[model samples]
Target: MKKDKFLFLLSKKLSNDISVEENELLTLAINTSDEYKQLADKLTKYFNQRKAKNSKTDKLRAAWTMIAKAEEENFEGTFDYAAPKSKFNIFSFLKIAAVLILALASTLVVYTLQKRSQQEIQSFNTGTTKSFKLLADGTKIWLNKNSELSYNSSFGKEKREISLQGEAYFDVVKNSAIPLFIHVGNITIEVKGTAFNVNAYSGKPYIQVALIRGLIQVSHTSDPENRILLKPNQKLIIPKALVQGNTSKFDIEPISTLDLLNETKWTSDTLIFRKEKLKDLAIRLEKKYELKIEIQSAQLKERRFSGTFTTETIKQALDGLKLSYPLTYTISNKLVIIKD
Candidate 1:
């Protein structure tokens, strides 16, 4: 219903007189959404038919606003129009996506889709909160705080590929023909059916892929020929190219940490760290609680500790951390300052 108005507007803007820039935007929206003429032709006819209706201009604008919301929710499947023959409008589909990738605007849409994925890239961002999703392939993906996952709706059809940021645990359904491929920046983790935890924070200087069950292959974009295969109970970390230097902030090896279950414990609403550096632990806590953490002393940041906490309060987490490390913290709004 709302999408119709968006398509109607696009068609009207193209047929009628509109600003040159607006026309260019609509044209780009159409091209970006889909290249299939059959789908586009059906949508063009639908738009033309709807344009003749006595719809107010505000109604069209309202539909444009709804596009952003629909994009946020990533409403699955196509709209059920009154005309069963009418297909989903390519322009409207791409316009909302364009908004999301451009600046959380359409540019946000472009940024997410510009170089990666084919067409039809849908993104899920878990900002300061964990999120769960039953993907198109029936795979259960649990994204940790401050994470993102983007995949096209036709994920299970020809290919099962998804781009990831931050951390996510996947319980993938076994699909031999269409093996799943996870894209984290330059590296790709290929798996057919497996349960694993992947930590690839955009800011973190390392990427870790820990396998719980099944097998996975980790490869880098720079070195396509040399790929590392990981077995069960193992983790693979790719040292990121830092602006400062070649050194990674964390270990760059595929080591198991069952003693702490350090990778996927957040899925159970628990934060557990076994001998993790104060700086790394601080970063994880900040993301888990959605707060800014400032450690006063550089020396204190190097302290290693082991702890577990399921507390909903940041102070409680801090208290648990203090048991092992000599640290005091002050909370000011969304910021936490820790001092030695």
Candidate 2:
């Protein structure tokens, strides 16, 4: 059906004047097309807002006046409002006109909302601490510092999907009929009731996913034919090359118990590093402490260190690193510089 016809049916549905057949048609349209679903949501929000602002009769009158004036002026030549001839019911003509006016009002509101609202739910962890969220579908997510996750308002209805910006740990509820999809850059992770940790920080050279349990499928967005199914205790690492290219050439290895613990310890506000390079470690430090870290010497940047930090100050964490290696760091203001 055309968009205008669907809108007309939607307006009738909202007004509780739609026939059973018309309601079925609208339901089918909503289920079949994402565009229709979004339109319905916008219109529903608009009607609810109107109800909150004014009485029912006043809201209806205002909507009818506004739409009738606009249509009489802009669509004057299209609709015939003349007195009906024989066999033409005047009351039916008036009822159809009212429904068309309602649809026009809904269209105006939808257009206004589209112009102003981005229509996505965004959860961003901009502070020095991690954040947690429980989705409407009973899925739990833990977002690390300086991370972001976003999904459209229509999420979890027919399919579950979200986009990730940095890092997160997800314990998804199982629903085979509606598997979850997580998009990170050019790679997509398909999960069906799995607990996994994803590290896709923008400054990093690679994106990593460690599945603690259940199953997941990872694929390059441009090359779906090149994919990998990851089993429990498996980790998939995609370098920048594979992410930007058309192939899914990446590394898939088994994750040890300790490895899983280190990967997910950040969810508990604990930072754990195992033989991590100084340069890579600086990125985590910067995010956790909201500071700027600069490694001065090339040798110092390549130095490896291992440690676990929980409830430790930035100075203390760096001091512990110095104990493991011959390094000196100077902290001034919000900046930290490291050297040999």
Candidate 3:
């Protein structure tokens, strides 16, 4: 039942003989697997209850003895052990166990609810400009235009977690004791010291994560049972509607040079677009240039364009777009109008 492996680690931890590495492995096992976590939790309460009752090792021995005796009696069907009577009442023990189980169940339900709605939230928003932020955990984030990032004040103390809207590039520091979690809509990306780009702008068709370095585990909040581990230079895309019935929809692909550039160049104030639609490009151009762009021709809005803009003015960038695409644009004050 894999109890031996768990028992060995539990025994070491209880005896205070477990090394740091063994303790980390034990923690990882409990955190990653629901089975291990539940088993550990149950056994922990068992030992705590025994200790609280001032019971000795004989009580534990007797519990196992009762189980073994019951099994043997079932097998032999004619065994009897009517010797000396003990003070241990199985019925009373069952009542105590029931109460403990109910208490633990109640606690778990409360915890699950509280984890969703945390207080003392700290939020940052990048409006029409890219910005840099350094978290308390030493993680560096480059938030793209029109993006917002928020985390609880309990961050770095109890848990390291943040929620993101729009796009951002994260350079997370290594902290095995407290792994970082990024919540983008329904998808959650677990990071253990990695650099990644997350694009999850509202109203977008999909959410994407591009792992530039290290590793990350991506899972949907609706489909926790399904997960995808992404390595360096790998990208994962999850549909906006991540869950349909019990099915989880996602795609994992290797990142190309152009793809990586397009995903992360915005962090450095460089906008890179590849086969991007004029309508989609307009949104980014509006954010980067902080102006209104109106496409008068419906046909021109669907046209695709590819280019990079770093130190270009709004007029210069639009002129560059017109070079490859058959389009004309006029700038008046802060408004830019594009025509076919």
Candidate 4:
């Protein structure tokens, strides 16, 4: 059915003037049209703002009168459902009340969909192994251990957006009209077409975004006016100090081809490190192995190690770490204790 016709039916449904046959049609149409929901949401916000400012005894009645005037002027006899301009009388109040009901009904639809949108979010948490997700938009994501990603099941209809925590690699489908938006910590990454890796563990000290291909635009929550465009092979970092209200800026860095590999290698179950602090590496190891690792020696935690280990058990990986430094570890139950 045409959108205007659907709106016409919707108007009748809200005003309690719809016939039994029309009520069935309205239910089916509304249940099927996400566009109608989006439009209703916009109108709900508009009415909410106006209602907040107005001091009229009958705010909806007054608001509808103003809306009828504006909409009639804009449509100029084009809209079939346009309410006629009549004085505010008891009889006219009934007619205006119907119009007001239609508007209020739209607000109700918007509110209901918003609550449903919140409930429709698909969430996944990765455990010791990496997990994969194929979004409704055909975007593929690799969620590393201790990470999570969530998006509405209705994604890509009105908007393409997602929420992320910990770390994940996104291979987004290209759609210039509907760019993908990812919220990582206090920053948002906008992409039309890109393959990127993001590290945004809440307990970590920094949020890192590394783009392997295509372009990406990043903006921080505090400094949204300034958008930083990341070209191919570039990495962007937002320190936790900035994410937690300690600072107010982004930290951008240029990444080489090799560094890009190092950043995203974990998606393949490979732990790659180049001069990473043992303390930081321990955190990564704990996440990947799902074990509690405690560094008993503060001196050993400060030391840096560089290596890559794939297809190795946690014990084997730690034994490899023993080769680099004078460190010893013992695994009991699920905890691994490392000491000088």
Candidate 5:
């Protein structure tokens, strides 16, 4: 059997589209001839190599050329001028080969174009209210509302690197040699097989690192001397530092995991607070829910509340808040104004 025919039959079988007769034919072909087995192995190797190389255009072109050459050779051997010619002659064989090549090449060209268009690098703006996911290497990353994640074509390799502007929860895949590196403001976090959350937006006053599971190492990209290793259920706070005369410094402090998880509840689309001041909790609510929350009374801002709320509508959340504090709120578009 020709390589193209074998590939067609193999693809049909793999896709579960082969008829019972075609399946039996394929089985007999493979068992009777070592050549057919070799061709199947070659096609499998080609596909595996294409995936490993990660260059779709080059691989598609190479695959089309190989298939065309194999078909031409197969046609030359299958037909004989000295043999009696039936309704199907050399012209029919050439026509079939040409049609197969044209169809395969056209299909591959369209597929390559579509894939390239979809894989283009895109940047997102979280203008006070946006949530997105950064998916790579079977890992799930939930970017908090008002947070931004930027990346280009060079993603997910020996070293997967991403720059963060706000807060995000990461479920990083396990690869000891190729660690996931996150660049947040001036700090850099290196981890291998871990789940953590990072909040380092420019508008924010402090850089926070919360490790939910696994181990992670956080260090200043500018000042290597400032390094901290965090274990599971540990948190670090990097105080906001000014860049004066090209000299910079940061103050690092450790916090409890319970507090960290409360801050990171956005990952689960839940908000939890424990006797947290209405003022302090308002800041977090705005960031997590991607809404603008304002406290009109300075004294009311100091009032504390304790409760947990799911990622519900702004109205419902505010109602829950009102139940705990003597406050009134009004929602206008994305802004939530509050007063006591």
Candidate 6:
């Protein structure tokens, strides 16, 4: 089916007036057709949203009205009830009904399409590793290595909200009216236009939010009563203990503002570390390269390393680690094994 025609049929389906046969036809059409996948996805989002907001009766009535309008506008004078030759066959009736339904359904169909254009605003993990750019308003977010970010299509009007798992750097466009909000694990960071880095891996013990510029407010999404206001060059650490309710709030300790420059060096395609521990460094390297790294000895994990690594292959990262500690690493495919 043509894009326009598929959209028309989708509108009829939404209207509750589609016959059982028509519904089956639409299912088959959408299933076998790749050209109409975009249209089908949009229709699915619209129907899901409508179902979320309206009661069953209201939805049914709205659909009935849509079908009635389509029938009236498309088949008005075309049908000759008294002419024997003009009497409708099943195929003729279906064709005429489709045309009329499509014409009447255009307005609603357009509205649904527009609303769902950004419906894929949230992309989940596709197993291995993937990267995507989120064009928010004028601000552009280059989602780092293994992270995922999601938001509703209708964001930024009331409150700009996004959920993050893993790490991402934000170059937020200055907008005072709508403050950008990021929810990672239990913590929420609110900011306007600012540049910042967030490391909030799900498996990790702590969530870290570092601000390079502008003011941001960080708080626990679950415990709204607790909050922390961060200034430029400030870093907030929500240790696993604190996040698990072992403590009420994260510790208020100031990290060297210089660390912000190193932490975000990945944005420039470089990995820089200053006096970071081997274990901590491994966590970052895993996320950066999307590989699994394991340290065999507990003693080896605590050794601190400090160096600046340019964008190099995983071998270079391992070599950099070897230079800092008396450890040997074996690489097999995507897995890195460390032995001492």
Minimum summed lDDT over a 10-residue window in model 5 is located at 244-253
Instruction: Please name the candidate that would achieve the greatest lDDT relative to the true structure.
Output: 2
Give the TM-score of each candidate: 0.43, 0.46, 0.45, 0.45, 0.45, 0.45
| Candidate 5 lDDT score relative to the true structure | 0.65
After best superposition, candidate 3 residue 319: deviation in angstroms?
A: 32
Q: Report how far residue 234 has shifted in candidate 2, in Å.
A: 1.3
The residue ranges of model 4 lying beyond 4 angstroms of the native Cα positions read 1-119, 243-248, 269-340
Of 4 and 6, the candidate ahead on lDDT is 4
lDDT of 2 by residue, 1-340 (tens): 5666887899888776788657656765664444577689878887777766667546655666656576668746655668455787554565576677777888887667655645656444546667666564657788888888887554565668899989899999898888899999888889989899999999999999999999999887777667789898889888866645445368888989998999998787656566689999999988888899999999988887665665679999888777666688899999999998
RMSD of each: 18.3, 20.0, 25.3, 22.1, 19.8, 18.3
| Backbone clash total, candidate 4 | 0
- Considering summed lDDT, which 10 consecutive residues are worst modelled in model 6? 126-135
lDDT of 1: 0.66
Clashing pairs in 4: none
Superposition TM-score, candidate 5 onto the true structure:
0.45
Q: Tell me the deviation in Å of residue 227 in model 1.
A: 0.4
Determine the C-alpha RMSD for candidate 4 after optimal superposition of all C-alphas: 22.1
- Looking at model 5, residue 159 earns an lDDT score of 49
| lDDT at residue 82 of model 6 (Cα atoms) | 86
Predicted candidate 5: what Cα RMSD to the true structure? 19.8
What lDDT, from 0 to 1, does candidate 3 have? 0.73
Off by over 4 Å in 3: 1-118, 244-248, 270-340
- CA-lDDT, candidates in order: 0.66, 0.77, 0.73, 0.73, 0.65, 0.67
